[model samples]
Target: MGASKVIHAIYTDDDVLMSAVKKIKAEKHHIEEVFTPFPVHGLDKAMGLAPTRLAITAFIYGTIGLIVSIVMMNFIMIEDWPQDIGGKPSFSFIENMPAFVPIMFELTIFFAAHLMVITFYLRSRIWPFKDAENPDPRTTDDHFLMEIPIYNNNQLELENLLKETGAVEINIVEKDEAH
Candidate 1:
């Protein structure tokens, strides 16, 4: 989409923002996006957005790390190097598993953290050297902003609805294409 007109409203309280979301969706207006300084409970339910899948990704990454560590350690310590530096049996992969656990746990946490961060960045369309598309700076501080895109004909109706929902301030903004 290029240069779509947007109506933005800023709220001071999260409860007021949540109430505005419910009210706007109930009246059948399309909410383009909502920005908040912090996570607001129940906001996703109000917006009808599904729960995030990052937890699933984290679990998969951790499982992969665990399996890889176990396989690598088994092959290296058991088959590759049959050492008896301290009378430790190199063939006992099961018996030596306890010593290998710290590395496995560290690898699991490393993979989970890196993959989860990458997933979140990609999902949010953010990356290195990419400019953030924050609509209002206040949204990063004490304000919650809801951006609702509407047809020109529905502008007045949307404005009226937002006013009724306790929006502290509202504006009709026009977005211009970058290129």
Candidate 2:
């Protein structure tokens, strides 16, 4: 199988990296990926990435959890166990609401937390015991990495562009299967 070709550029500063990205975009170059040591403010906007809907999804999921908790608690407590164990009234939903508050709150929290985590995991394509693809280890430290996939085999032109954008170092990555 033919390995995919990828160009890697290392940057020391986020500002410089952003500037480089802007320049590259102006020249109509395709930016495959960008790796940074820390989250850069407004980077997503600069890269034209859509705003994340995780918060909205989480709210909807949490609301579902809360409603399910309330309904389940009311059905179990009022219908199944109508006995007033502690002299508490259980004939009316309003009266039994106070007694069910603890379970309702617990279930709401449980569902919200668990569902949010699962949503995040699924959305981010991450899971337990799965090895992640980290393009550059230096991105976890202080270095920034910008990967631009050349579509027309124009390394010389790309090298000039990287040089003009103040790229500290540029390298080519070749992959081979070990096993």
Candidate 3:
């Protein structure tokens, strides 16, 4: 396959970028990615991305944490080492459940938070100490970058469309060619 050409359309305003994305999608053009300094409200919807499932994952992780906390506390405090919980010798896990509430709550939050971060990192292909993959460094500041891949050798048409959509600067960059 021939090396694809990537068009980087730089827009200063997110409103303009969002409109461009809608227009481009209407033309049935596939947008590769969009980079902005901060999150742009409704950009994901504009790009027609599916809703994120991370929240569901977080809830599942929290449930696991709650179960773990209950099991671990039962083993440690009630079964293995029966202790005087709340100045009462509560030998039952249910009876001692009140004292374990705080631990369970904290563990639920901890597991959900930590696991969610790891999930997001993995999903984004981000790892610790990794170089940034942004095509332009300016996108990290005040600029927004929209990357579109050219197919069918329709470069001029794409360029014209981008120019009409209020792109401040448009650059045609070649993807890394493999020999």
Candidate 4:
């Protein structure tokens, strides 16, 4: 297939970008992506994107960490090598559960935080030494950019709509079909 045409709308303010996105969606245009310097509130919902499942993964990781800490503590303190301190014998995990609570909590947090970051990076297709996919470098500073793919020869209509919605600059770029 030939290269696809995409409209890049640059905005100086996030409010204008949000309004443009809503207007484009109202007109049934497909937005390929949006780049922003900082996280915008409610932008994902406005883009019609689904909620993320990162929290669920974090909970599962935390549970696994908690279970690991419990098993390790049980084997070390109760089964493998038991010690008596302050006239109390470490023969039962339940009897000494209080001392293990801190370790369990720490491990849970550690696993949740570290695994959550790794999962986010993997899911986003980000890796060390990878080239950036950002279309405009200004987006990393203060500008916001919205990318909409042209379909059915509606580029003129989309350009007019973008201008009406307060896009400071509109650019038509030929996107490589390979991507």
Candidate 5:
């Protein structure tokens, strides 16, 4: 494949970045990616990306954690070694469930939070010791970057549009096609 040309538009403020994104989308140009120092609200909607399913995964993880906690507590308190504590004999899981509520809640949150993070990392292809993908490092500090790939000899048009959309700095770079 031929090397593709990409335009990197830098913005100082998120508001300007947001407006630029909106204008770019209005012009029907496909945005490759957007990098920001912090999360920008409604950027995803403006980019026309689909809604994330992380909440559903978190709920599933929490349910699995709850089940594990219940089973562990039941085995330890009722089946493994039944002991009389607080003047009550540990026999039935239902009867002893109240004392296990705290553990259950904690385990549920732990699983949901940890597993969600792992899921996000895996889904985003982020790993320890991985190379950074942002073309400009300033996007991590105090700038926002919008990447738009040029196709069919539209570099001049895109550059003009980006300049009109309040891009502080615009750069055209040749990016090797990733296999």
Candidate 6:
């Protein structure tokens, strides 16, 4: 079987990378990824990525936390073990809600943070102790790397196009299908 190939276009500046991305999209080429040393503003829009729905997941998680705290506090302080919380004579959970505000707030933050992390890991197909898939280490430091799949015999033409887009280094590499 013929090995798959890819082109790595490295840029020294984010501006150059952004423009190159636009050009690549205009030509109807698929971009696998763009690695950057830091956050590049508006780069996601340039790449035509859909807006993330993580905020919606966080809201759901926060709501779950709120419900759990309410049920647990009501059961523990009222039903299971009635106590003189906040020096209040009435032991009803409804009347003692003021004392539980801090607990509710804390649990809401805690659940949202933990669930969001797990959701991110699941969505990204990442887990603890997984091997790194970065094609180049320089992309972690100062270089921005753009990856484009090579189909048929377009390596030279893509290389020329990358160079025109201010790419500092262009490399054609064989990619393994099975890792």
RMSD vs true structure, all candidates: 1.9, 3.1, 1.9, 1.4, 1.5, 2.0
* Candidate 4 lDDT (Cα, 0 to 1): 0.93
Off by over 4 Å in 5: 1-3
lDDT (Cα atoms) of all candidates against the true structure: 0.87, 0.82, 0.92, 0.93, 0.93, 0.89
> Candidates 2 and 3: which is better by TM-score?
3
Choose the strongest candidate by TM-score. Answer: 4
**lDDT, model 4, position 1:** 53
Better of 5 and 6 by TM-score: 5
Query: Model 3 over residues 61-125: C-alpha lDDT tens digits?
Result: 99999999999999998889897745899579898788899999999999999999999999988
Model 5: residue 75 alpha-carbon error in angstroms = 1.1
TM-score of each: 0.91, 0.84, 0.94, 0.96, 0.95, 0.92
Quote model 6's TM-score: 0.92
Per-residue lDDT value at 173 in model 5: 87
Candidate 2 CA-lDDT value? 0.82
Between candidates 1 and 4, the one scoring higher on lDDT is 4
Ranking by lDDT: 5, 4, 3, 6, 1, 2
Tens-digit per-residue lDDT, 63-87, candidate 5: 9999999999999899999999979
lDDT of 6: 0.89
Greater-TM-score candidate between 2 and 5: 5
For residues 83-157, could you state the per-residue lDDT of candidate 6 as single tens digits?
A: 664577546877888889999999999999999999999998799899888889998899999988888888888
Residues 64-171, candidate 4: write the lDDT tens digits. 999989999999999999999888899899999998899999999999999999999999999999889899999999999999898889999999999999999999
